[model samples]
Target: MSAKIQSSNKKGLFTKFLDVIEVVGNKLPHPVTLFAIFSLAVVIISAMAAAAGTTVDFDRVDMATGETELTTVVAISLLTAEGIRRIFSEAVTNFTGFAPLGTVLVAMLGVGVAEGTGLVQAALRKLVLATPKKLITAVVIFAGIMSNVASDAGYVVLVPLGALIFLSFGRHPLAGLAAAFAGVSGGFSANLIVGTIDPLLGGISQQAAQMYSPGYTVDPTANWYFMIVSTFVITIIGTIITEKIVEPRLGAYTGGEKASIEKVSDHETKGLKWAGISLLGLLLVMLALTLPANAVLRSDSGSLMSGSAFMAGLVPIIALFFLVPGIAYGMAAGTVKSDKDIAGFMGKAMSTMGGYLVLAFVASQFVAYFNWSNLGTILAVKGADVLQATGMTGIPMLIGFILVSGFINLFIGSASAKWAIMAPIFVPMLMRLGYSPEFTQIAYRIGDSTTNIISPLMSYFAVIIAFAQKYDKKTGIGTLISTMIPYSLVFLAAWIILFVAWFALGLPLGPGAYIRL
Candidate 1:
């Protein structure tokens, strides 16, 4: 009785904490409205800052000449006439040109076909059924960790599928969703294979490193080894958290009949077989294009990771890959009789994106306004100056950097964009203190990725909320954030400890990268 009382007391405290988060978060307006408010705030703040002559000057390295030059970033007041005119004129383009807008829509088209024909559902069912009962949570978490290879596609595909898989096993769907989201967003920077972000952030770090060492180049594979190790670290941590904390708190499956497991029929099994064959064929074709010395996917220099057509076109390639297999499954299942069915599937997918489209428009405007105001850059510069003044060095300093980066990540959603602004400052500062840009970059990544699952500003955060609402209508930003706080906090701590250990041991971060300069 006393043991049960202690457990109940712990549960009560946790529930109270979550209640506080929900109340505070719910007090805020809708996400769309919040973005609009942020946009307006940026404009007002920009005008005030410009009036006060706010500006930052930093040295920049010229890529072409390998020379250092001074550049100044003055606050740009969006309240000005030209700014107002530009904002009005560019609103349409901003909405249409948003990065997530196009990629998500294109990918969903193919996913829609697979889902509509029962292909995706059958495949997920098979995946879960094939896994040992004891390892279901681990499998979901591992799949989520690996899904980063396709970028944001994981948020769209794997997260909801995880929930469905858990539900079919008479488990709490939200716990499954949390576990997957933790892996996809929280473990984003950890992958066994080099991802699009490796090149993107590498390019930014190279530019920053050039300021201190002319003609310096940061390889895209700079963090590959560390991240490869991190993949397992995050998987193990995520699995443990899901099984011990999240699932227990969520308790047993209480959702209605829709959540029950249903056996796959013969037709769906046939569809899965056809889809598997089609997927294998696609893999063979991709290999044929990439493996040969003179293949089209290979760079002129014969490298697959850098300056390659394959790396550049991965998103579209993934879309087409899914499209073909989806169509094959649909046809095998007799759900698609003609090309019209395919078109319909794509159209239906696009239609469901209406809310996201609206959110994207407002979000794009806010992001643009923030950039135009130069506030993010100025804040980064000031933050760097403060860190530099601290006189801290070694692992402690890097841990401090990680904390700063995580805090900033709550406001800035885009990894590459934040890194672009931060690298020009932190990378050079760290280099002067006997650290390599690669090491600094990894520190930044640890902070950036761990907080993503909780940040409302993250591009797909809204979509995750929508996914959650399917299970519980009352699901809000707080519900997700509160649940994910454990993952974020634990991941941050574990990753930092790993980084410090690697640093102390003088281990190489990658093949050609080290912690110390």
Candidate 2:
């Protein structure tokens, strides 16, 4: 009895800690406002650093000449007359030229159509419903991971479906919800296919990488290979946690309502079949364009993956990859009756991105100013020097970076927003330490993803709590975080181990992306 009381007290303290985190996180400013503030702060700091004559010298490789030269970066004050004029002149271009803005918008145009047409939702339901009862946990988790392809569809669709499916099987509904949440949120960075986040983060990393190497390009597929492997690893781990830990801990379902799993309607099934056919047809067309040595999509060197027309047009290709199948799905399902419907869907998608547009505008100015001031370059060099001086190079330093990223994730829920701010510092810093931007980006992603489930600041966290309350009236922030903490802890450990093993084996993070420069 005494021991039980002691354990209860410990749990109570842990709950209170999470409650504090929620309060603090909630009190923070909106992400867009935060970026605006960051932009202003950068302007002020640039002036201060310039006044103080802060500078750094580093060896820069001349891309055109293939020669290394010592380059000195002196902080430029944004408050100066020339700086103020440049900022005013470049403001419009900063927003327009931002890499992530166009790529994410283009990609979402297609995803929005697919999602708007109900194809993504139907596909997720079909995947989870088709799995055998014994393998349902793994399937639910896998479905959640794959649902990232359609943005927030997993949170809105699969999460609650997971609960209903579990209740249908006479299992605890919360266990299924936990499993889905684990995959949707905790395993966010792990997906078999490239998603909107891939390009969004890649663009940010590329922008940051350019601070160190002018011609360096980080492709959307930079972390594709690692993410594909992580997908299976997370699935297995999530399944194990769901079955061996979370489910058992919940004991049994005592909820009032009995719910059955919703089966896909006939039209949706037919739509999926047509969508699959269209997808295959699209693949065949792509193969025809890239298979031959003299193919139109091939590079001058006859490479398809590197410096090729196909590689350069990847964003449009990805857009079409979804657009074609989505159109087909919609037609067969009667969700789309005319070309006007497709246009309307696309417009609706862009309309929903108003908040993102505002955030991107401010963020781009911040990035441009940081670059213009030479602050990012100087910081990278100084940071690298300090790390090298301390001899913290290699796996230990990488692990520490990941931990810091995870800790920051608790307060800031937007992955792209956080990366935009962090990449300018960490990407170039890691590059100076002899790591590739791709490696740094993937490391950041791992940390960012692992802590998402327990973060109250996550955009979908409130939605999750609302979902939980349907089953348990007492479900609150503490209860949800406590349930998810096990998944978060296990995923962080397992993912870091995987990252270390990958590093040790000298594996390619993605096509043409290596561990070192």
Candidate 3:
């Protein structure tokens, strides 16, 4: 009785804490407004910094001479007459020139088609249903992780389907929901294929990196190798937590209603077969283009990974990878009757990007203002000096950064938005400490992905709670967070361990992306 009372008291306190978090999160300004405010603040700060004669000196590699040269950066006040005119003139170009804007829009166009044709959803359903009952949990979790390829489809389809699958199997429905939710939200950054996020985050990182190394480029595949490895690691860890911890805690399901698991129809199966064949053909064609010593896709030095034509054209290639398969599936499944249908599907995909486009506009201005002021460079140099002074220049510092990223995630939901605000500061600062921007990005992702499931501020958290309430009416924010906290904690630990091991072994984070400069 005493133990039960203690548990209840603890639950009550946690509930209150979450209530406070939700309240505080609600009071924050919209991300676009926040960026607008940040841009104004940057302008004002630049003036003050310039008046104070703030400057920092650092050694920069001179690309022309291939020699390290001492460089001094001084704050350029945006309040100057020239600065104000430049800002007014550059406003239109800033939005147009933002790196992430075009890349994300292009990638989503293809993803939207695949999603519109029901190919992604059918594939997810097929994977979950085809797995043997004993291995169903792992398959559901894996499917959810991969479903990120189509954005929010995993949350809308797989979360509820997981509940039905478990309930049909005489297991706890809530456990299934938790498992799928863990994979989709908590494992957001781990994927076998490059998703839209790769380009979005990479572009932001590249912009940040250029604040220090003017010509440096961070590719969309910067974190690909680490992400591929993390996919399997998260799958195995997620499966263990679901079966051993989440399921046992949920116990037997005494829910009133029983629903049948939906099986894929004959047309969907035909669509899958055609999609697979098209994808295989696409891969073979790519191999033919890339495998030869004098291949067209190779770089000037015959390298496939660096400065290659293939790397430069990767965004369109990814689009074709999805578009071709999507069209094949659509035709096979009778979802596409004409070329007009395909056009409509693509247009539909682009339509959802209205919010992102608005957010990107403000964010671009903020970044542009920061770069013009030279404040980012000064701050990075000062931050690196401070870290060097304190002797926290290695793994410990990286871990601390991950923790800070995760903590920040609780207040901001959009990954790109948080990264936009952070990349300018953290990316350059960590780069000064001898860490590559790619490595800093990987650390940030690990933190961002792990905390997503537990954050009330996550855009999809309310949606997950709604899905849960269908299974158990009493389900709320606290209930969902309680169930998901285990996955969050375990994933964070496992990823940090993986990161430490990867660091110790000196493995590359991705193609041409190393741990140090």
Candidate 4:
């Protein structure tokens, strides 16, 4: 009886804590408040670091180089007006030239159009509906993990879709959303399919890790084999956690106001078919451009997969794929007419992103400030020293690194940036301790992706708030945060444990690769 009482007391405290979190989250303001808070927080962190004589290595290197020469790189200071002019003149020589800006923008245009069209939502609905009931939870989670490549696609599409699918099945919608978000946001590193982020981040990781190993070659798919398996692991774990812990607490759909099923008439269905045909045609054309050895889509080289213009321009291509099909579908389906209507759709899409835009603007500045200050580097180096001193080889070091990475993620929201700060220190440290850069990278990804579900600083936090609001008007950052915290905690624990087991068994992280050096 005493033991049961103690358990009840513990449960009571946890419930009270959740309630407090919900209350605090609800009280927080929207865009302006978030902006101010995040901005001030970054400023404060920067100042404190500066005051403590902190400096970060904000150096740029050519990761493509297979050089093994070790070097120490650190950020100096931001340029003033004269320095800005000097920077502009030397742009061509700069490693991080403005070339990427154009690529990113051009790609986003295509994405904007597709997201404006109802195609993404319609397809997701059909997918969720078609999945077997038993597989629904896992499917939702898996879909979330794969959606990362699309940027905000998972937050905008899958999260809400998960809730709707659950409601349709007479389960708690929030629980379903949690399951999907956990998979998408937290297990983002564990995609069963290929994604664009692989090459981009791999490039950065390669550059950073090379500080320790001049000959280090970080494969774009270094973590792919493990991620494929982890996809299922996360899906199952997410499903079980949601159904077991989350749903029971929420009780029922008594929260009211479920989104009504769209009554797609025969005409609408035909329009969808035509839209699908148009999309297929676009894809076929894209494939043709890709399939040919000497194709226009190929980069300066004749390669079409990686080095090709088509693959390198994937983000833009994806955006275009969505825009063209969505526009065609809209016209054929009679959901759109005239240039004005199309423009309106695009305009509406942009408007919906106002909050995100605000968040991103603030986040970019914060990232810039932190990078400029070089505190991340100092912290990471010190951390590497601590890890090195432990002399824990193999799994223990990997686990410790993952935990450290998780801690770092709390401070720096951008995965690439955090990895940039981390790779130089941990990669070299692990190398000396007899661990591989690939293993360090994988462990870092696990920690980085999992905590995104709960981090308020993530650019997508506001996007998730919008998703939650669709279910309950009362849903705010606090509600979303509180709801998803369970997922973040559970996923972090379960994933770390699984990673350790994989390490213990001395399983290869990928084909022909070992976790230990």
Candidate 5:
């Protein structure tokens, strides 16, 4: 982006503040450096707390007999050398044992086939291209938000495609990147399609909540409606911010880089048609499986909303949902003609995972260390304890919780890990304070998502930096941080207002839910 600011463009205080953070944070240290600093700090804090015997000591439990009883104290402590050894010794076991890891990979296998067969990209391009320019922004943004249902596809496909889409229209590619990045990362929680992340985090949160309330549950899509609405809200906000704020600030396109456009390859066109058929067939099969009474796909409770078999197995279903059709489309489109061909498609999909594997490896160790140390548990329990002690109710408590979540996210970028650490203490503590698990989950999601753009520790930061390099070789962490900081601020402000207003209005956050405190 050009640094020449338009004379008509005026600076605001908040904009300047973001600019400073961008410049300062980029220069401070690499993301890995900052992450090491944080891990060290957590270790120290955990050791001190363990020494003090400050832990998640259960104050009391409301037993089945309706009596309050003091419960066993679960002390939160830091990892020991033994724990580190255990983690390293059982690295493979730990990797394989983590159900979500394999599940994510397996689910992606099918998604990769679908994407590799050129089904997903073609569909997106065709669908969005036909849309009017005014509506295109929202469509692309919404698609970017929904792409989370397929995980890394958004980063790999949508981000690049977004920049291309903007450049085709004689607009700055960075603006498109800004738009797509906002939806993909900042508005992560808000999506029309629910993905594996929902259940993974939900399960973790439920387990955490049970530390105090045995019967507590945290729904994966607890904030679905709000998020769905936020998709549109973010589209508008992102467009305005990109068009009115960042673009003008960066000035004109005098940069050395040349922007070239991509053509619709004949193969890509054929791929679209076959992929369309595959998508239709997949949809039909899903409907058939789900339509009949006592259908195999239905939940145990026989409702689509709760424990439905399909909902419960969303990860596999999502995989099959994409893979089945994609494979068929590939065969028809001549991308794949046999099982080996299919395997090749999957192999291609898996290839992209190399970088993710590296990130996940380090992230797993960090998470394991933190878990063993019990630092997260201690912080969570202590924070919840303070909240309960304050006796603050309703909006203040919820808003404050969001703030805390945002703060935690700066250090801990993994949503499930952070929630796993926080859920047990906060979920139950809030329940005791007369709140719902869903409400707490919703607040946690808002906080977790909003900071993703600004946090260097966010796993995708490296990928995003590479994305920027395509447009400007000079682009670095500081450039990315500066580019993304606007979305973080804008999204946080709008989302917080929407959530607080929702709280005041006393609306249900999701299906069969209430937001009352």
Candidate 6:
């Protein structure tokens, strides 16, 4: 692998720019290390700010009295003995109580089983390969978008499959890879159906919103409407980027290695059939539980989307939704022979999450410390004031926020981790600006997701580089980032446009969630 070829590809001007990003990004420390540094910095900053008598005032509605009262929040330094003791005491609780930790773990448990059964792989391959040659690109992009339903399945399964599919049809494999990567990572937040991230981020948003409005509730389906629309928007934009920009740059596929096309097996097909049936049956059962006036899943007022058992327990319900069908497919596919086999699959699934567990611990403590020290509140209030002073309001402020979030994503990879830290600040600030936490969450999601492909910090970026290495062994960080930069730029622009339009139209973000308070 030649380093020169990797850094200076024939892509010219853009490659040079992306090379800079790769170089600068590579200099940054690991995410865990960065979080540790950030935590320390927060402590020192909190101390300095506290000593300087930093404070902010915000109006909060009293739950009991039903009246608005002004409250002054003063930054508390974590440098004191009591602060240190509190930190040491709450360290374990912080990690254990992190909003996204358990939700992601439980969701991945079900996802792991499904992926372990080979059902997700088989289905994705079938979806891509079975499509007409003319629509292969569109289908690949759409499948990539839909693959978010199962965590990381799109990257591990669909991306390579897409490349192979395109290569088999005599198209550029890198273009195929780009298209699939765009859909999987860039369009991550856009899914026709609600995904694990919906609940994960929604939970974080709810926690942040509570800092201002204690009784405010954020449902998992809070961004369902916007994301559902985004599904098609991303698909179209991803297809255009792949067909117009990416493919033109690559020109033709003259790579030496023969692209190996993978096909679905008869047994895998049978497994998919049974899995689909089981999934449909599960949906029917869920519908039965929610559709009736006196149904168990309904709220006391018979509302399905608000204050309802089904809505409140969406995480567990999502877990079971994945678990049952996974078991069904596993049994049909001979993957689950006995109870031990199922247990083994579950364990294997958890084994992959070891890194996430570590990341979650450090990230949780950072968020908790920030919250306990009143830094998040004071910062948000002050930040809100600054934004207000800029005379940026409504759609423009929202657009500015999207760009800011996108910029932060270049450094931080974990969507939930970033949201965990950011939600505390941005969610409340936006709510004060007359926007809902759910609305703010969806904006963060767009920025976080759009830049995922271009960011070296993304957890799957290395995996993608390795995937690209199959065709070009010299492919390195610059090579991969350069290829993905187009998608990142285009996705950000198109998504922002969609968001602006949605905001202008005053459309509801989800079932009961609106753009503004």
Query: Per-residue lDDT of 1-517 in model 2, one digit per residue for the tens?
Result: 9999999999989978888888898898998889889889989999999999999988886645657788888999999999999999999999999999999999988988998899998998888778899999999999999889777889999999899888888899999999999989898999998888999999999999999889888888999999999999999999999999899989988879688766899999999999999999999999999999999999999998878998788888888988999999999999999999999999999999998999999999999998999889989999999999999989999999999999989999999999999999999998888899999998999999999999988999999999989999999888898899999999999999999999999999998899998
Please list the C-alpha lDDT of all candidates, in the order they appear. Answer: 0.79, 0.92, 0.91, 0.66, 0.70, 0.86
**What TM-scores do the predictions have?**
0.71, 0.98, 0.98, 0.69, 0.77, 0.93
TM-score of 6: 0.93
User: Can you write out model 5's per-residue Cα lDDT over 1-517, one digit (the tens) per residue?
Assistant: 2344542243354456556654554565543444455556666776677778775664555534446665545444445676556656966654555434665677778878887777777767766677787766677677788888777678778887887777667667777777787878887888776675776666655555555555555565666677678777887887787788877766665545554545556777777776667678888888888887777898766787666777567677777888887877687677777898778878887887775465445444555555566554455556666876777766888888898998777766778657755665577667656676777888998899889888877878888778777877887766777778888888888989989888888888776455743
Steric clash count of candidate 1: 0
Give per-residue lDDT, candidate 6, residue 360.
83
Query: What digit string (tens of lDDT, one per residue) describes model 3 on residues 397-490?
Result: 9999999999889889999999999999988899888788999999999999999999999998999899889889999988899999999999
RMSD of each: 6.0, 1.1, 1.2, 6.4, 5.3, 3.4
Model 4 CA deviation exceeding 4 Å by range: 1-104, 192-227, 248-259, 265-268, 292-311, 336-389, 408-441, 455-486, 497-517
Better of 1 and 3 by lDDT: 3
Better of 1 and 6 by TM-score: 6
Candidate 1 TM-score to native: 0.71
lDDT of 1 at 342: 91
- Across 1-517, the per-residue lDDT of candidate 6 in tens digits comes to 6887765565576667766766777788877777788799889999999999998899876544568888988999999999999989989999888777888888888888888888788888878768888898999999999999998889988888878888888888888998999999999999998888888898788878877777888888999999999999999888888998999998988888676776677778788889999999999999899999999999998888877998888888888888888888889888888978777878998999898899888887888787878887787788888889989888888887888889888877889878877898899888778788989998899899989998887888889888889987888887777788889998998988899899889999999899877
How well is each residue in 1-517 modelled by candidate 1, as lDDT tens digits?
A: 9999999898788777657644565565666776788789889999999999999876655545756677787888999999999899999987776554665666576666766676765765677668887898888887787777555657887798788878877788999899889988999999986655676577667756755555666766789899999999999999999988988987886656366456677877888889989999999999999999999898999987566887656546667776888899888888889999999988887788787688778876776676667765566556656766875667788898899999877766778656755776688777656578899999999999999987876878989999988888888877788789999999999999999889888988875578877
